[model samples]
Target: MKIIYRNNDRYAIKKLLLDIGEPELERECWRRKLHKPRRINLFFLETNEGITSLKYKYPQKGVETIIDVSQYDLPECGWIRYKIPY
Candidate 1:
């Protein structure tokens, strides 16, 4: 797992997990915290996945943060990849 910290920490987790490839996704978990500079955390449901922590200012007054998480089950390869979008 890759953990990235950014001034806009909200996008860090999303950037970290986007590499994972998933077929479909269901639920999501989100959090806002009081850290050095404030941030957001998100966890995707239906895949037992979690985005540990994020530190970013909620969009001041712009477009919402768009995040997409998915799950891919490769029966033949015996593996599952979860793709989290930023």
Candidate 2:
């Protein structure tokens, strides 16, 4: 699967998966976390299948935290991607 983050371009899961065993992808993920702004807001993930999920992430005490939406009936997409601005 692929995602278009912040309108930059679509990125495949291979480019963003943390457990993919790719050093460059891991570095890119870190770079994104570092560059992402620290704010409380909603983020959207839209899939090619027309399913959308809402999420949020922030830093808490030096650790990155994500607002859990696991209770919601999100579609079984392979992974989360495509950060839409709120």
Candidate 3:
């Protein structure tokens, strides 16, 4: 699917999930390095072709990241929200 981050004009996702070493608490030093402040704020343009969901699985860490990008249906709002670690 075609995904574009509204904040930037790029047509693809960028700088997401740099390292999945171990689970770290929110606001922790390790976590900060994993997901930077700018990377976490994802707002996609509201379109039919927008992303519906995003899933990432790390077997070693036994961590599964699942984010439903379509739940917050803001009709005509012109944006689809998808935050990291959701």
Candidate 4:
């Protein structure tokens, strides 16, 4: 997945997800300690059905999550790509 920002930490990602009603994902992120200096990569894409999916991987914890955010209204930044991350 392509990272929107190289410096984005899990704290920022969790806050955004929580604000968007993704409490489960937010809780899951805290399952393990990401003490490394490396930041986690957050990947997002809009599906053909117009649903935007956000995904992230926690390699150290062996976990990953995908969030369907079609119900929420996301601000327009003129940078969201519809392509799915591979």
lDDT of each: 0.30, 0.35, 0.33, 0.45
The residue-level lDDT of candidate 2 at 30 comes to: 68
lDDT string for model 4 (1-86, tens) is 54331213455454556566545555544553332223435433333445455555455654344556556555344343333386
lDDT (tens digit, per residue) of candidate 2 on 21-86: 446434544655643433323233333445332223344434332222233344344453564454
Ranking by TM-score: 4, 3, 2, 1
User: Clashing residue pairs, candidate 3?
Assistant: none
TM-score of 1: 0.19
Best by lDDT: 4
- Which is the winner by TM-score between candidate 3 and candidate 4? 4
**Model 3 alpha-carbon miss at residue 71, Å:** 6.4
What are the models' TM-scores?
0.19, 0.22, 0.22, 0.40
**What value does the lDDT take at residue 73 in candidate 2?**
48
Which of candidates 1 and 4 is the stronger one according to TM-score?
Answer: 4
The C-alpha local distance difference test score for the whole of candidate 4 amounts to 0.45
Better of 1 and 2 by TM-score: 2
Per-model C-alpha RMSD: 13.2, 12.2, 11.5, 7.2
Residue 43, candidate 1: C-alpha displacement in angstroms: 3.3
